[model samples]
Structures are given as structure tokens and as C-alpha cells.
Target: MSRYQQASHVFWRCQYHIVWTPKYRFRILKDNVGKEVWRCIQVYSAQLGCEVVELNVQIDHVHLVIKVPPKISISKLMGALKGKIALKLFSKFPHLRKNKMWGNRFWQRGYFVDSVGINEDIIRRYVRHQEKMERQEQAELALD
Candidate 1:
């Protein structure tokens, strides 16, 4: 199980599974470019107080599993991640900008996001039990 981080009052374990692809699903991320992207991800994630659980930079798409603090919203995080990575890549690999599709885009506008942690069944069972206990307590009081 993943460990939780605590704030002054809130305890959170927010992890997300994210996947995105380059514009048009081009296989631009390979070899040195892919390696650089990986490095930037690690560096930027730490800067944003996120723990990168797993990262896979494939030829056409990238996959990431990360734990982010509650303070950072998912949209904000994704914007920063994609924006910064694109800037860094265009800077290091100037040739990429030559292509029309790559002229102003790196990753596609949207990405896949899903919450990852704990089982839904566990939460359902916990809630049901609590409701049952509450109902039983109320019934006993009514009979008294």
C-alpha cells in the first residue's frame, strides 16, 4: 500500500495514472529525445512536490503514474507537465520545430487521467457497515 502524506489537518494519498501522446501520435519521442523527456519529468515532478511512481516514454505515447499533493489540481499539473516538457524538448531538439505539426505543438491537447489507489469495494463496504450500525443504534433508542 502507498503511504500517505499529511498536512496540518488533511491526510492524502492522491495518485494518478496519466497517458498522453504527441500531436498526431507521431513517434518523435525516441532515443535521446525520449531520455531527455524522462529526465525532465523526474526533475519537474520533484519541483512540484510530486512523486513519480512509474514513467514509460514510448515512441508514440507516454505513460506516467504519479502521486501529487492536494494543493495541485490535476489540470494545473498536466498543463505544467506538458507545457514545460514541450518547451524543453523544442529547445534541445531544434529540428523538431521544423516539422509543421511540431511547429507549435508537442503533446496533444488532451490526456487520459484516472485516480489510482484503494479499492472501490472497500469504500462501499465501509459506508454500508457504518449505515447499518447507525440504523441499529437508532432502532434500539426508539425501543427504549
Candidate 2:
């Protein structure tokens, strides 16, 4: 079951796959930390009239499939999302600051985002595969 969004004069299904990681590739996102990051993304995305179709929060990176409106620029949306998450995470978990030895930053300087259209299902499958791969990698590392 898929739904499309509508504005005053336009009907659209503008979706994107966005991925980003923490600075220095730290593995600090776990337990309560991961939960807070998810919450922040959900709250911020909703504020922009966007819906999170799928989201995956890994220890070092986060991925999301978001349904956005055509009115907003992708860069603007990402900036707001990243900025809000960084501010909230820093405030909610002060210990996170210690990991930022180089500078007071949460996320890396850049992100990966792709527009999703007819290949939406393909993108979802890719995200799911990412989770599986990460789990397998962790299990293998644990055995080492």
C-alpha cells in the first residue's frame, strides 16, 4: 500500500535515500544513543512535512528512506535534519562530546542521498541488505 502527498497545486511522491555517518566513524551509537538519534530524525523529518518510509540506525551510520515534498530543496532538508540531530544528540548525551577530539561535531562533513522513484523497491532492498551485511560483519569480528 503506497500513498502520495499533495500540496496546493501539485501531487508528488518525492522520496530519497539518505545516508550519513558520525565523525571519525565512531561506534558510539548504541542502546539509548541509537534510540535518541532515531527519535530526532523522526521528529525533524515530520516537521518538514516528510514521512520516513524506512530508517536504519547503525553504530557508525544511519540510513533513511524519506518521502518529501517537491517544495523543499534536498540540501535545505538535509541541513536542517543534520543540524537538529547534532544539537539534540550533544545536549541529550554529553558524553558524546568526548569522542569529538578533532572538533565539536557529531556527523561527518558530507552525506549520501539518492532520489527514489520507480526504483523505490530496489532502494529498500539495498537498505535492508545493508543491515544484514553489518550484522554479519559484526558477528565475524566477534569471532576473531
Candidate 3:
């Protein structure tokens, strides 16, 4: 076999930065709830064969930097993550089942995704900063 043929079979590292918010942007993930939500995200990501490189659960949204196999479609991966987390969260915390949280859906229809190319460090820092940003926003809102 040619060297070129052997090189073609190599797998490239793929990193995906994803961000999504709750339906209607509800601030349901407060205090300890955020930890639970993060746990659910971790569990779901593991089930989907994705490595959770960085993750932050804010009051209204979440930021996740994951490394997924090339075989998975972005939509399918997102759906699986959202679905599994939603089921686990709602089942664990019945209050989240209220219409305010989401009657039938856990996440909003749209999500932000970016390929972390050479800026993986920047994206990781951004994901980690999500919680701090959320806290600052809450503090600002409280001052009003």
C-alpha cells in the first residue's frame, strides 16, 4: 500500500464547542441545581461517546466543549445529549417538569456550535467563564 493510502486512514482530532439555553431562557439552574445539571450533562456526554473537555452550567444556559468521534452527526449528538439530560433531570427533580421549565422540551430549538480549530485554549476559557459571567449578570440585575 502507498504511504498516502496509509495516511488517509488516520483519524483527526475533532473538537466541538456548543452552547444552548433553556426554553424561554428560564433561570432554573440556581445553586445546587447547577451541579446536578452538570452531572447530567457529563453522564449524557459519556453515553454518546463524547469527551467532555470543558463544561459550565449557568442559570439559563450551558457551555460544553466536547470531543466527539467523526461518525456522529452534530444534530444527533445534540439531540441525544439534550434528551438524556432532560429525562434524567426532570425525573430527579419533579419541579422541573412544570411548564415554566419545559412541558415537553428541555432545550431551546437552536444552539451555538463552533469548531475549535487552533483556538482551543480560548474556547476552553470561555466555557469555564460562563458561570462567572452568569453570576455577574445576576449581581447586576440584583442592583437594579
Per-model TM values vs. the true structure? 0.79, 0.88, 0.82
| Candidate 2, number of clashes | 0
Go through the candidates in order and give the clash count of each.
0, 0, 0
Query: Model 3 over residues 1-144: C-alpha lDDT tens digits?
Result: 431111246655678899998889888777766788798888877887778999888788888998877778889998888887778778887877876546678779999999988898988998888667777998999999
Candidate 3: C-alpha lDDT: 0.81
Error of 2 at 90 (Å): 0.9
Q: Candidates' lDDT values, in order?
A: 0.83, 0.87, 0.81
Ranking by lDDT: 2, 1, 3
- Best candidate, lDDT: 2
Q: Give per-residue CA lDDT, model 1, range 1-144, as digits (tens).
A: 548888888899898878899999998889999999889999999999999877777777777888899999989998999999999999999999999867688999999987876653443343335435566898999999
Candidate 3 lDDT for residue 82: 80
State the lDDT at 130 in candidate 3.
69
Better by lDDT, candidate 3 or 1: 1
TM-score of 3: 0.82
lDDT tens digits, residue span 1-144, model 2: 546767899878888999998888888778999999999999999999889989989888998999888988889988998889888888888887776472778889899999998899988887868879887998999999
The TM-score measured for candidate 2 stands at 0.88
